[model samples]
Target: MTGTRTVVRHAPGKLFVAGEYAVVEPGTPAIVTAVGRTVTVTVRAADEPGVVIASDLVAQAMRWRWRGDRLEVCPGQDGPRVRRAAAHVVSAVETVARLLAEHGLPAPQLHVSVSSDLHEAGTKFGLGSSGAVTVAAVAAVAAHHGLELSLESRFRLALLATARIDPNGSGGDLAASTWGGWVAYRAPDRAFVLDLALRRGVGEALRAPWPGLAVRPLPPPRGLRLEVGWTGRPASTTSLVAGLHRRTWRGSASHQDFIKTSTDFVNAATDALETGDDGALLHQIRRAREELARLDAEERLGIFTPELTALCAAAEAVGGAAKPSGAGGGDCGIALLDAAAGHDIAHVRQRWAATGVQPLSVGPTPERNQE
Candidate 1:
């Protein structure tokens, strides 16, 4: 493990094109795209015996040690509580360490530095920051160990680590982070993957292809422009998702209807992408937004805020379709603008700003190490 060179990896943030809530259920597909913003991790060999992780997004240093078969966090003498942002980093390090150890290779003592462009000032824009960081960190650590993982393996490792830290996530973001470009994804069976990871070890479980994990790349629709705008307020996706779970949204007629509509939207959107049918794409986008709005109304989930409503209205005024991106109470909303609409994108941006939406300049970023 001598003379290990530094490895840097970058993973892009993601935006949900459609199939937000429904994608949480198994077999339900979501459309996601990797955006220009990214989280980058640099891993290098260190003289110390333990690993040290620092992040620009999180103003704390994470130190960890491999204790036998387990990885334990080593807080400083001041006893600072680990922030939520550190979970993904810790998860990536643990997974990588376990994989190396299981392969009879000593886990390398490394220093990992993370930086991100997923936020404006201190306000998060609801970009899949955690997923991007997890992917980047895992890739960097694995590269430092001379392990080259395929895209699917990278996705699996990120998903496994994320699920272990936050079991509620669907891993759609992780998929986009791992494989840039447009992606159609279905949530993997967590219980099965967790069992396999525990029994087969991280190295073995990730070496083989995962069953029930579907992530297919899709070409971006022609004549379509994605316009993203921030609501200037961060939303707690975990809290909103937890509330839905606590209310037993599953198995209910409303929930069933929501899923059915979302599935229809996904199919229509996929076809539209394939055929370059801008009309169909816009229609499905608006339809999906309406269905989500209805679900929020009926279930009293309050997933839609006034800001989101205004954002949709603004996009509609320009003959575009818009909706809240993820488990949205706030954060960001995305508009699918028609290239032939002849509408001034600047006008739409101005309107959005007038309504307290800050337009973001973003697009699909190339895959990690490609740019």
Candidate 2:
């Protein structure tokens, strides 16, 4: 938006390096990394009252009004009051407005414009686009209101907005988007967090000690080349997680085993990253692939598809380690290889092309580690 007063912010998308389904539970450790792809949010003061959020991905800009401490759709809009298209944007505005309200400030008029490069020809690469968008929106909106939030505060507000939309998220992607490099993340108890926010206020909730939330930076690989492959189809993390939730496996011993095994290796992988143990990291990647395969077998979650299988097989054939990146029914996968082995990398790409997998030229976002 071109306006006298405006703020723009960018947040990078993320891919899960290791740790998946089990990370949904509070405090479960996971490794995630920020990618070069990003979503940009531009916030400008509106000419009149109310708010309008327009996304390049969506057809229409949604209008909303502040009803006390919340945002409600203006009467007679194209879609319903709460739309799936701009759900993250809506939640972000409401959450930040609540925070402003707690500080005795009136919610200002806004026009939030969003643009994202996380997709190819309108198809998502499954690189946590929602998380990136939320993070960017929260930061831009807060800044436009003259609120200079610390990294921790901005992350907290983003997570709160995310939880308000869907409490089942692990928030690891948010950590990657906020921090801009490899990170080891643990989720907070969302139910407790939402309740605290509702009862007390955003200011108090921001100050409260979240029981299981943690985020730490991990060292980058010294000699491994990270390659991403897209399956040309998008996968829904929500549906995959919901399928797991529907099964009566939460307290099952096998489920407990899955959690335990995933946690152990993710912790080990963190250590390997710290020590620059490329071989050990490769071992953990293989281990993670096996664990996800086992979980799929036990739960019938369809976590793996033929394309993903080929993607992994091709990586292994090229003397590399690979696995499905996230929920991975048909989204994206990651592989690590010797940085100098260009021939092997080309062969791997050729195999992926033969199997209908598209290798994406994505790398870690060029930025320093978060302090």
Give per-residue CA lDDT, model 2, range 223-310, as digits (tens): 9999999998889998999788888998799989999999999999999999999999999999999999998888888888999999
**Roughly what TM-score does model 1 have, to 2 decimal places?**
0.94
lDDT of each: 0.83, 0.88
The TM-score values for the models, in the order shown, are 0.94, 0.96
Which regions of candidate 2 deviate over 4 angstroms? 1-4, 80-82, 366-371
**Which whole-number lDDT from 0 to 100 does residue 258 have in model 1?**
84
